[model samples]
Structures are given as C-alpha cells and as structure tokens.
Target: MDKHLIDDIKHVSLSLFNKNFFGVYHGSISARVSASGFIINSKDTILDEVTEESLVRLDCQKRDYRWSMANADVHIHEHIYET
Candidate 1:
C-alpha cells in the first residue's frame, strides 16, 4: 500500500470515528490503489482496527481478492474505477 493512501484511510477512518459513524466493528473503508485495482478493508473487520497491511488488494479483472471486500460498498469503488 502507498503511504499516502494509508494516511488517507487513517484520516477518513478517524473522521468517521469522530462522527459516530462507526461503532466497535461497524463500518469499512476503501480506496483506489490504481486505475485497475483497489485496497479495501478486509471482510468483517472493523474500521477502527483497519491497518495498511490489513487492506486487501483487488484487481477488477482478476477478482482474486474479491471476498476480502465482501463487507464494503464495493460497487462505489467499482464505479469510480469504471469512470
């Protein structure tokens, strides 16, 4: 994972925490790692516990780590990649 993206996730997750948007294990966050790929929170993992290493890498064409993103709003990321 890129340091910048890890930082972004930290900031976004902290912001969500501040807004009471996530509880102990409630929400997930993800970001595009590249034009054809993304790194998303692992399935069932809590937002507060997310770390750079825990973010699973996924390639749209490969679908290798698709299950890792089962808990996230993957369609949004897919749309972003599509556009």
Candidate 2:
C-alpha cells in the first residue's frame, strides 16, 4: 500500500534480475511494511517487472484469501518476520 516501499522492492527485484542473482522464476523479495506485516511478490511475477498488484501484503500472524497469489515460501517469510 505504500508507493515508496513498492518502488524500493521493484528496484531491488530488477537489480537482482539484471545481475543474474535471480533466474527467470527463482527468487523472491520481501520487506517489512509494518510492525505486524510485510509485503512480498506474488507467485509467477517477473522479478524485473513486479507491479503493485503483483505484490501481496501479509500479516505476520495470519493467512487469508489474499495469500493465494503469494509464493509457497510465504509461510517461511511470515515465520521469519514473526520472530
């Protein structure tokens, strides 16, 4: 929901993709957006072109329908943030 955060994530995603640090579909990026949650790229997103809609905002403590588009590794991310 934060444009600045979204742009920051986009920049990193592109940089990693350009540097070969990320393959066609091999990497994902996330950052804490709030004390209780974080934002991450949805599954199937092109790392270099992730738009706001391709991002999922998740609560560190719970899952919801909005989680459908999140990567399968989302649970791991959530757990990391929770702790």
- Top lDDT model: 2
Residues 1-83, model 2: lDDT tens digits = 98898888889889999999887777888999888798888888888898998889998777688788887678778877884
Separately for all candidates shown, the number of backbone clashes (residues 3 or more apart, or on different chains) is 0, 0
Worst 10 residues of 2 by lDDT: 74-83
Superposition error at 56 for model 2 (Å): 0.4
lDDT value, residue 40 of candidate 2? 81
Question: Global lDDT of each model?
Answer: 0.72, 0.85
Report lDDT (Cα) of residue 2, candidate 2: 84
Could you tell me which residue pairs clash in candidate 2?
Answer: none
Residue 78, model 1, lDDT: 66
For candidate 2, give the lDDT: 0.85
1-83: candidate 1 lDDT, tens digit per residue: 68888888978887897799977667777777777887777766667666776677777767654655555676666666653
